[model samples]
Target: MSDFLIDEELLAAIDMGSNSFHLAIARLDHGEVKKVVSMSEKVQLAAGLDDNNNLTDVAQQRGLACLSRFVGRLSSVQANRLRIVATNALRQAKNGQDFIDKAAKILPKPIEIIAGREEARLIYLGVSHTMANGGRRLVIDIGGGSTEFIIGEQFEPIYTESLQMGCVAFTNKFFADGEINVKNFNKAVSAATKELLAIANVYKEEGWETVVGSSGTIKACRQIIINLGWSDEKQTITRTGVEKLKEKLLKYKHISELDFEGLKEDRRAVLPAGFAILYAIFNVMDIDRMMYSDGALREGVMYDLLGRFKHEDIRDRSVQALVGRYNIDIKQAERVVKTAQKLFDDVAESLKLTNEDSDLLRRAAYLHEIGLAISHGGYHRHGAYVLEHSDIPGFSQIDQNCLSHLVAHHRRKIKADLKNEVLKVGTPALVYLCLLLRLAVLLNHSRSDQMLPAIELTVLNEQQWCLTVSGDAKQWPLLVADLHDEQAQFKHWNIDLIIQSEKFID
Candidate 1:
């Protein structure tokens, strides 16, 4: 139950997809992931949405029930080792935070609702790792409320897009009457193709050597294709097979009469609409065949978690890219990060922090000065603005919010009125983190290579902390003055910041 007794090598990922919820538990073997167990449930969380994008009571119950089952299976896993991600449904929901709050009670970890582009990236990562290397591979993942299309080479993605078209949404919109007529099918296909038109030209120009598909819809498509003798026994869906299936689909005028050998009972209702979308994709994108991949978002999440543990963090790369784009001073960032980390280590144990917390602080330190590229006056607020609004890859909304909070308060007078807004979500952690970062920035006020005095941080209690500085009193008057000002900021967060100078003490 404790952090010390937990095994960091065992990782789990829960992908709360629109149509289904998938859980994958894996172990880190050398550098690769070896799957130990996998579980899935047809929660169809996306289909439970009402007109206003609020999940219905029935839908909430179904999702929670599925999660409860998953939680039982994850009894042995630690919270930090697990990553739970919600997709399109949660992203579109009006009262999403309400649902998240309820789910958090049963689940072992917090849920992260990833953006559409992020979903596309992770899908490509999942598909790319599962398939053999090709020059450029196009990955298509058709879910309940969204479909992600990505073009990538090896493990890196070049073009990523997520369309609003999905099986469940399309089915509800065009085929909810269950009339499998040519008219309805054409309408659905035309609508889906229209969405693709914007990306078609560019995607065709970029091109791909192979096409791959993931998720339940595509998997079911491949199964039906093989069962119908449209493809070889290998179970891969081909362009020719798709055409044959489309011809057969048109023959049935209604969903009730449509009984296919390979189609499962659960997939029957949505198959007609899903097929129309796929057929349109094949026609529009010139996809001849798409190899199916077993791995998708859940698998990618596991790999991403493993990367964090191994120090090959994508967030770090994202930070570097941000710095390069804004032309930030690398030396200044390094100076700040070095000082911030030293101060962080001094108070980490007393503050009851984790390595993840330390990493986030280091990243915040690196990016704290990014807005100086815009203007020097009130640049802390500007930096926070950029981090909060910009879509930095490999970071969730919550991650951005936390980073922005740190940058925003890095130098400002911590106001009491703003306390509830920032601390409401991050609570005591953000308060403590901001204080530590402020002290670090104050200590490095000169921004020079001159050695800093040996400083030790101690927490007398949750609301009281002392900084013991060992050096000559006259060495740094500016730093002492800055520290004195920082104390006022700490008082706003109810923390009494005390400074102790060894030379003056004895």
Candidate 2:
């Protein structure tokens, strides 16, 4: 909220797709976003990944060059108002962090690698916003490295899945040589169908009133079908249209020899591969017709940003749902949340904690004890696992990872290596947040509504934090022991957690 402007505010989203990187800049008018600027480049980040799942230097450089250009077009947007999300390629790359680290230097903001389901959710959001809302719809997005299938009514996704097959990835795997013979074409379709095998039965059973397609690959296919006069009068991609395209595709022995009217040069190479995927979906899912929508992930990201600015953050709703589902003690969670907020306020400036970081801390605090629902024994570990693995909409993988770290370390004896294992960078800052969470959890151990004494937390320095508790230390023996234990835990993390009762401070 601190970084957003209410009226005529500019918001931007960079969708780092495996095949292409896109930037969308928009201005919020009333409750809608009007397109301001859009830019995209074929980075083919996924194609650069080798067998070892590492992005080659060439690929990294290509990505960075494109990001630098994207940064130039973002001159008018504030850093906080922008969201950059990477999909399958970054999620699959073993050395993604290295690429992200390099790209961070050239980009305006940190790149968030989203999970597949989150991608599906956002894709649905984008599609729903731009399409007519009535019946349940099935949306498909064929990306460079992954394909997302989502079933939803209006904006809410009922079923979301991200399969490990995409146009670019499939091309590299099955059609790397650009040959389009029947053997290779069948192989690609069969492979995609195999991946869909798991979800086909369930999705078909649930059904949908309409089928929609998004992303560049789908858009390209739709245009090619229409241009070739393969589609129906409404320009919808029909089963007959797809079958005709497939028949035309197998005629060419190689991709290079093929030429179509509406297909662009940049999209020509991957068209066959993308078409194979689309054909497979049609056959496997029993799809009769599909309509294309201009809205996709970037548009969804813009809408999500608008929601955040309007205090309708979906992540908060996600946390609340988790809390309720786990049957967590609401009063106790509030206690920890309130205390964590107070502690965060005290050291926010000193620790350079941004509003987003504060939000993460608060959400982590509320869900800290969610693991108790599983077992009180090692509940922290269970909680961490849940937060790390659960499909919570509106939360990116990074957000979930940070929350998992805070929850994992909230009540445990600080393992010296835990800090390094749980965090790659920002170890100190995360450890500090973890320390605050531990203190809040410790202070609320009693879980009573009794009034707490005035407490003040101060940052004496990077390695020292002083807490003053205005109460009779003798009366709160459990709290005193808890504080002492926390002091030792802080020490393990190389922080001096000093505490003083009113009398001791005096």
Say which candidate scores most in TM-score. Answer: 2
Report the C-alpha lDDT of model 2 over 392-449, residue by residue, as the tens digit: 9998887888899999999878877877875684446777788889888888888998
- Candidate 1 at residue 338, lDDT? 85
Clash list (residue pairs), candidate 1: none
TM-scores of all models? 0.93, 0.96
The whole-model lDDT of each prediction reads 0.84, 0.89
Clashing pairs in 2: none
Q: How far out, in Å, is residue 195 in model 1? A: 2.0
Worst 10 residues of 1 by lDDT: 1-10
**lDDT assessment of candidate 2:** 0.89
* Model 1: how far residue 329 lies from native, Å: 1.6
- lDDT tens digits by residue: candidate 1, 91-136: 8999888888899899977788888878888888777777766688
